[model samples]
Target: MGLSAVPSGPGGEASRTDPAPPRDVAGRGAEAARLADLVARSSRGHEDAFSELYDLTASRMYGLVLRILRSADHAAEVTQEVFVEVWRQSARYAPDKGSVLAWMSTIAHRRAVDRVRSVSSEVARDEQYAVTTVVREADHVWEDVEQKMDVERVRKGMASLTAIQREAIGLAYFGGYTQTQVASLLKLPLGTVKTRIRDGLIGLRDALGVEE
Candidate 1:
């Protein structure tokens, strides 16, 4: 049996194969430029411009909050607080310091840290499992394969440190425990905990090639 030819639509002609339409590249560029201008104006107390800036940056700011907080409920709460802070402090942002995204990320980072620390020590002790869950989730979010590799590199750089120094730093920073808390948890002297944290930070600063 011979294969039947497919029928064309309408005209007695072969169907035309249309090429994909071109994207609105210039439009996107113009929109981004407009948003940047709006943010600049908003930073100077222009209410409408501030609204537009909020629209542009809110999702990105939320993503950062979620990554750090790891609880959708807490993240949402923090996201609102972050924008409120941005609206109040917009005038303090200096373009020379960094881009809008960086400034917003910095704000989110500080706020997340503060929120994490504000959980009272007693509550934190009682809710250790909850804190561990949040930290594990945050590690999954922030330390993907690439970031894990970077962490390994950082660990290698701190190779000169004794096990106690490494553990002290990890508990204080990654575990979000205060020095006194770390000492209590590790059953170490308070002074020893302090020395380990300070020395470990100095060692890590060198290992990670961070400047003073």
Candidate 2:
């Protein structure tokens, strides 16, 4: 429902103010391999491996959901749903497609986004019905139209970003991750992630016709 920072720890646990130490490429690869193996085992009905997978990833998944939903209770429930999907779909995971963490993050992002859109759709329906029941002032009607146009403009602007830039911005803004976390997830350097976000925002501002 809103964007909020959720402090994350090394293993993606939330509520830790300390920044996680950076990992070398080899270290990241090792972690990815570990997660992938766990997934594979879990898919084969290894209960202990599934439990370990939950332990390793739940905190980070919860943080991501919390950032998008801005509600701890909803986040917790969604996090549980995410892992259930993970368990059910673990066999479908392909190491060739991406890291296990990335796979799980995608699932989390989609589930959270779906929840937000569901709520938004319900609100929009109620508003539409209400509109037929009450007459609005001309100016208020114009304001509503303008707001809808602005939202459309913003969506178009986002479509203008380069794939990498769009992805970085999505993780940082919509996915509720810090630049550092984005870099970690993307396996890019911190500075590179910062540049992408900066350039992406500039592009979006220009698209919106906003002056510096």
Candidate 3:
């Protein structure tokens, strides 16, 4: 699907046809294995490995970020941030936790979400603050500790979600977009978006050990 232009930050429009860097997949077999190896080597301070990883995943990651942000330039910037985090946190990645692409995609999603949060309307920002304030007012100690833990649990659980489910939840809750808006942004049917959000929430509830 073709993406429309959204206003960029200080810089002008990002080159939609930016040149792709070289990829080194000589001995790599399956896509998952290739990504895993590059991530492992990158964690061990292999610059070449890191370069290859970027070459392999950057475009796709950038595209995903662009979809969420709706700005080519900001998407490019956030995609850079995502790779920086990937280089820094690759060692912490566990194979049992998820595939390398999924891990990287999670990082991309989070960075894009953060960028969107920063650019979100003041009304939404104030609403988020009000919600936080209310939580703080009720059983301050428990809310503080449990809220942190629950948020972390949900973050972890989010990575395990199907791509559509994860994106739907991120757009609705994190992007401060309504479900209809999320559906529009994602170019998915409203019913599909609703189902993904409902199912994603249920999965997150289980992850947080909340009773159904």
Candidate 4:
């Protein structure tokens, strides 16, 4: 490895060599071919191929999911979900559209986003559940059906907001936390948390067709 000079900054980061630069494109093509083959075999129910594929990519995919999720347990769970989907849907991969790693990472990122959305929706559903619990006089059958419908609506509506907005609003409104508390929990500025909550609620309202 050789060092390369970079501009000095407050952190004073130093020069770094880009590894495998000489064969970067060729290496990627070869790697893509290898992974595509593995995916194809895995799709055909080859246990060995799937095992090798996991060995080659699981760490990278887990790291990517962890960064997005910021929770070890959630990240681990979603990482498994991503891999399971990959094995199930491997036949759907099209190299013409992108490289193998690109396809895998896309699945990982989407799964991570879904996990975030699910958490927020679960919070909203919990609130609705509490309401249903308090209103015990209602017909049990209709109440259960209505509760399910409401939770489904929240799931659909929450998807429209950005992940951060959904999370902030969930904490404040559904999780029963104040805006200040949400800010503290998310480690964001109070105004930013407030704005996310506002924007998120507006989006949800529009999705649910709430007037005013």
Each prediction's whole-model lDDT (CA): 0.67, 0.75, 0.72, 0.71
Local accuracy of candidate 3 as per-residue lDDT tens digits, 1-212 = 33345465323434434322112122222667889999999999999999999998886697677666766556667888899999999899998887788789888877777677674522233333444445446644564453455456656788878899999988775564778889999999999999999999888766544321
TM-score of 3: 0.50
TM-score list, all predictions: 0.47, 0.51, 0.50, 0.47
Off by over 4 Å in 4: 1-23, 120-212
The total number of steric clashes, by the backbone 3 Å criterion, in model 4 comes to 0
Comparison by TM-score, 1 against 3, better one:
3
Model 4: per-residue Cα lDDT over 1-212, one tens digit each = 33445454323423224431222333345677899899889888998999999998886698676555555666677899999999889889887887678789888877776665665633332343344344434544565554556556767889989999999976654344567878999999999998888888889878765322
Q: How displaced is residue 177 in candidate 4, in Å?
A: 20
Q: Clashing residue pairs, candidate 3?
A: none
For model 2, how does the per-residue alpha-carbon lDDT over 35-135 read when each residue is reduced to its tens digit? 99999999999999999999888866876776676655566778999999999999999988877887999999888767755755323323332333243
For residue 201, what is the lDDT in candidate 4?
A: 83
Q: Over the stretch 140-195, how does candidate 1's per-residue lDDT look in tens digits?
A: 67655644665576667678677888889877655556788899999999999999
What RMSD, rounded to one decimal, does every model reach? 13.3, 17.3, 18.9, 18.0
- In terms of lDDT, the best-performing candidate is 2
Which of candidates 2 and 4 is the stronger one according to TM-score? 2
Q: Pick the candidate with the highest TM-score.
A: 2
